[model samples]
Target: MKRLEGRVAVVTGGASGIGFASVERLAAEGARVVITDLNEATGKAAVQRMADAGHAEAVDLVCGDVADEAHVADAMDRAIDRWGRLDIAFLNAGVGGAFGSLLETAVEDWDQTFAYLTRSVFLGIKHAGKRMGEGGSIIATASIAGLGGGAGSHGYSAAKAAVISLTRTAAMELGPRRIRVNAIAPGVISTPLAHRGKESNLEALCARQPWPDTGQPADIAAALAFLASDDARFVTGETVTVDGGLRARSSDVLGDNSMLLAGRTGMNRGSTGLKSGFRNTDR
Candidate 1:
């Protein structure tokens, strides 16, 4: 049987990038999907694309800002109005917000960052959780930046970290109802949010990765599908990192040979009270 058969899902930011990819994947997996986004034109085009692909019966569109609580409620209401129930909520809308040093960051930018990324997820869970039944999954788009530094900009990282923390707390509260709450911490994917400038080179970005392959939006969509499906029934309050090994190696491991000297001198001790060691094996 198809994984999401008879399911009804609402995906915010469903016009493009990871959100659009999730919308497509969920619909293709036998769920009736409602795609919500800020751009009505793009949202309509996305639905048209689905219709052209013969998924017309499986998809719908709602145009609104995800950060707005009223809009969020309306989206969920529309999903239930058409499908009779809500089973999955993918609160994936976000903005890059503040991108520079924290010292230079303005308070307004910080507020906007959380309003867009963190608050949107909070509202999604609040409204979606109320309408969900025995089996429901709520997934949010976090970032590797939320896990640590050097992965994202200042306000964006903080907002995503809040998303992760909120997911854990929400899962604990919603566990009794058989509803699952989870977050996806994606690495540097080739999306408009990842590379800012219109002239940015995605190929160059991919070459810098440990695996040398840029993560596609589809990779994240596939992960979201898994978490939304019964396959992840036992998983909740957890973050599934899809970072392509970016977080696996520390700066010491990826840095110069000075780490080797520090290791020998006992100056490279980590928080675990063990000296960092590097080994090269000729296989």
Candidate 2:
């Protein structure tokens, strides 16, 4: 039997990137999923694509902002209403965030950053944790930037650090109920958000990482499925580093990582909570 044959899942930001990949991975592993994203059209198309791929009866979509409590709750409810129970929640929606020095970052941008990255995870945990039964798995998308300095912009790094904390705290409260909470920290992934719309440039940078192969969405999806499956039943409150060995080396091993974008003032906030696409968002 597939690891998640009888499970039901909710994945936020399911229209693209790691979120979309996780939806497919979980379904392929025999789990029925309810997907949520900011863009209605793209999100529906993704569901339809999966349906065409033979998971027609195994997937559904809900279009809305991930940071909204109502949407998060609704996504969880959709899973239970459709499949009878919620076994996994992948709170993996995020955007390129306030990418500037702390002093240069605006307060509004900072709040918005947390709202999109951290608040969404909090809502997912609150709503999904309540609906989940024993042996449920809740995974959030964190980043190596949260692990230490020199890896991300000021606001983005802080927001991700908060996610890591949330994962641990949620695990403690949900553990006794047999629910596992975990986070995955990906490195310089070859994604639209990471590349800032320059796929070729991002691919080249990813290749330069300590790991020879560039990090892909599927790499993180594989890890997410592991955490979601019974195999990780014994694991909880941990952040799995999926950045290959990039974090293994010192941050300055290849010159200061921060210097790569130092002094470049353009922030790269995206429609992650607003939409899963990696396109730059003005708001």
Candidate 3:
């Protein structure tokens, strides 16, 4: 039998990239999943694709903004209603957040950044905790940028740091209920959210990592699967770094004030037309 044979999962931002890879991984492990994304078309297409790849009955799609209180709450509720139980909740929906220099960042950009990157995680934990049973696992997507400087923009880094904090605190509160909360701090993954179609630059920048290979969405998905399964039953409130040594060394795109562009501040572009998620925003 598969590791997660009888489990049920909900993955936000499940339309593509890391999110889609995670959804596929979880489903392959035998978990029935409800996919949530801002774009209904993209979400449905993804469900169809996953179904075609086998496990046709194991995946479903739900569309909503992750930051909205109503949408987030309902997403969790619907998963339980459909699957009869919720075992894993991957609160991975996010945008690159407000990019560019801190000084030039707009107030609206900062607010929206938190809305997508931070608030959504909080809502996922809140609703999922309420609905999850013992042995449940909750995972959030954090960033290496949250751990240190230069890698991400001002607002994006701040928001991810908030996510890491939220995970620790939530894990403490939910431990008694047997629900585990944790965050993954990914570095330089080769996703639509990372390269933004700069395939040339993508390979060049990502391969600069100490590991030499570009971090892929499947790599993160594998870690996420472990956390969601019984394999990580004893782990909670930890921020697992999956950056391929990106954090151990200096970053070229990190805002060092040397290559910092002035007056060009906005949310980075993304695959969903949400905050552009290609977070290497110095360009």
Candidate 4:
């Protein structure tokens, strides 16, 4: 659609998964894209694929770690040097934490999680916002876990929650400069990260989706492209959920007996306060 024509975008972790998909989408929409990834070889290959597809001038690759401020700053500087300006920045680099409860999680794991997920986003916003003068957009890849309590991994949930809060505050602060900041909360997307586990678990997770299927990297890339385009000029301080309706259904489910008892005791009152034992059962 050429929605991002003449614009310049920097995507961290752009060698794989959602970040790579975003790079492809932005390039297709006529934006000059610079990819920053920790994997040097894959990052170059990703750019080469784009160049081979006749987008040679529209793509650039930078090898770096998002968790490092110097690397991020250099990446941004490279984009500006090439394209002369930066219009969009997608802070999509993140690492899955070790699966464990809060008490079982180690301090180093928590530090690494915050470094890659939360602190990386912070640095992206700080440096990208400075390079982009006015009318720029910053989109971060937050997860559906950011919206509520998570299961299994405490570090991932906490970091994602911090990302959401950071996005909102940045939106408010950067609004004065016409810089929009937003986040996308994706659910159960089939990517390299998810496939790193057992195939059975991945299948089971996908099967439980409310919709007919799970999400893909492109699904999130589409949402991010929209947020980056001028069409979303008025969008800010918002989080768009692209989870295929999985999260919309309330997670609270009870047995028939419990439902019957609550109904009989007037505990399941319709959005109205009611006394049930020692608790308010209006929900």
Candidate 5:
């Protein structure tokens, strides 16, 4: 049976990476998918490819900046106008952002990161929720960095952390209407966002993962499919992590555990040099 037959879905950042994979997966499951991205040419090409792949009737393309409220509203309007309703919203648009130390980071960069990463999700939920009926699913692309620091840059991590927090809060507010809000916290995925279109670079990093294979966009897409289907009808306000066991073990898994373990024994080794490790020694 087609899991999402007759359903309508909107995927932001659908031009590439996990968003594109989710668009494909949902369309394969019989969803009428609306692909939204900032790059008009790339987005149109992606939709054309889907059409070539036999999903012609199931795909539409909408190009816009997700961070712009007007653009977001228009995208939703376009979806509802075409399909008469919206059933799934995947707020996955984001930027790599400027990487630097706290003092070196610019305020404008921070604002821009949050605007696209966090604010976009908020706007998506706001508009999508208004148009949805009883059984809608809203999912966002958070990051393993949201859980801790080592996973990403400062601005990116902060934005994703807010995303994780927002997912729970949105779920609480939307649950009364039978709308499910959740998030996917992906680890180092082999997308342009992480590997910069370099497969060899991604493969090199994959060697350190417990799964020993870099996470493909399809890996996260599978999770998106599940969350969008009836299989996760009871799930909401949860952040499902899709890291290849990267978060299970610290970055220095093969390195010294003595420093971390020592902190657990109440050792006062407080310093301002290193970043992202156990800070409390109460245990």
Candidate 6:
């Protein structure tokens, strides 16, 4: 639709999953896309694939860690150098740490999670906002866990919560300049990060989803494209949830009339037919 024609976009973690999908969508919509990833080979190959697919001059790949200031700066530099101006920044680079409770989680692990998920957002907003000045959009990839208490990987939940707050503050600060900032909280997307489920009980996980099927990276990517485009020009400081009705479902589920009757009599602790809820797999 050429909604972003002549625009320059920087998508962090663009080598795979939602980030990669967003890069492809942006390029398809006529934006000059610069994909940044820590994996040099995959990043270059992704750009090449896009080029081969007829987006030859619209894509570039930069390799660097999103948490590094110099790397983030270099990515921004590359986007501006190639396209002359920056219009969109998708700070989607993040990692999901091992599942563990807060008390059992190591301090270093917490630090690393915050570094990539939270501090990296800070760096992205700082540099991208500075370069954009006005008429730009910054979207962060948060998770639904940010909205509530988490059971596994406490650090990730906390970092995502911080990302939401960061988005709000950045929006307030940049609104005067007409630069919008927002976040997307995806539920359970089937991405490389979610592949950890294959090693576990996949059946049980599938049963827990409100929808029959799991979400795809492209779902989140499409949301990103809309947010980055002028379609969301008036949207800012918001977190749009992309869950498959999982978050809105009721937690209580009765197995049979016997269980319901038992619950009325206080015979069970409202747990006779309960099962372990699905874990947060968004990264």
- In what order do the candidates fall by TM-score, top score first? 3, 2, 5, 4, 1, 6
Q: Between which residue pairs do clashes occur in model 5?
A: none
Clashing pairs in 2: none
For every candidate, C-alpha RMSD to the true structure in Å: 11.2, 3.5, 3.0, 11.6, 8.7, 9.4
Q: What is the C-alpha lDDT profile of model 4 across 1-283, one tens digit per residue?
A: 5799999999998888888899989998989999998778778888888888898999888887788999999999999999899999999987765334344445766686788889999999999999999779999999877777532245677889999999999999999999999999988887776565455546655665678876889999999999999999999999999987867666521112222233221111110111122122333
Q: Model 1 — TM-score against the truth? A: 0.86
The clash number for model 3 is 5
lDDT of candidate 3 over 1-283, digit per residue (tens): 9999989999999999999999999988999999999988889889889978986789877899998999988888878888899889999988876767666677888998899899999999998998886669999999998898777778888999999999999999999998999999998888887877776656655765788788899999999999998889999999999988877775554445322454455676477765342233445
TM-score of 4: 0.86
- Model 5, span 143-254: residue lDDT tens: 9878886566667778899999999999999999999999999987878767654677566456767997778899999999999999999999999999889778875533
Off by over 4 Å in 6: 197-203, 251-283
Model 1 per-residue lDDT tens digits across residues 136-234? 999999998788755656677788999999999999999999999999999778776555344254555355458877898999999999999999999
Check candidate 4 and list the clashing pairs: none
TM-score of 3: 0.93
Q: Higher-TM-score candidate among 3 and 5?
A: 3
Model 2: residues >4 Å from true position, as ranges?
A: 253-267, 271-283
Residue 87 in candidate 2, Cα distance off native in Å: 0.3
Stretches off by above 4 angstroms in model 3 are: 250-259, 274-283
For model 6 the local lDDT of residue 237 reads 98
Quote the lDDT for 100 in model 4.
Answer: 44
What is each predicted model's overall lDDT from 0 to 1?
A: 0.81, 0.83, 0.85, 0.80, 0.81, 0.77
| Number of the candidate with higher lDDT, 1 or 6 | 1
Q: Please give the distance, in angstroms, between residue 71's alpha carbon in candidate 2 and its true position after superposition.
A: 1.0
Per-residue lDDT for 1-283 in model 6, tens only? 5888888999998988788888889887889889998777778888888988899798888888888999999999999998899999999987764234443445666676788789999999999988996689999999977877531246667889999999999999999999999999987777765554463423444455687877888889889989998899899999999977766764332112221222221111011121222232222
Show the lowest summed lDDT stretch of 10 residues, model 1: 265-274
Native-to-model Cα distance after best TM-score fit, residue 41 in candidate 1, in Å: 1.7
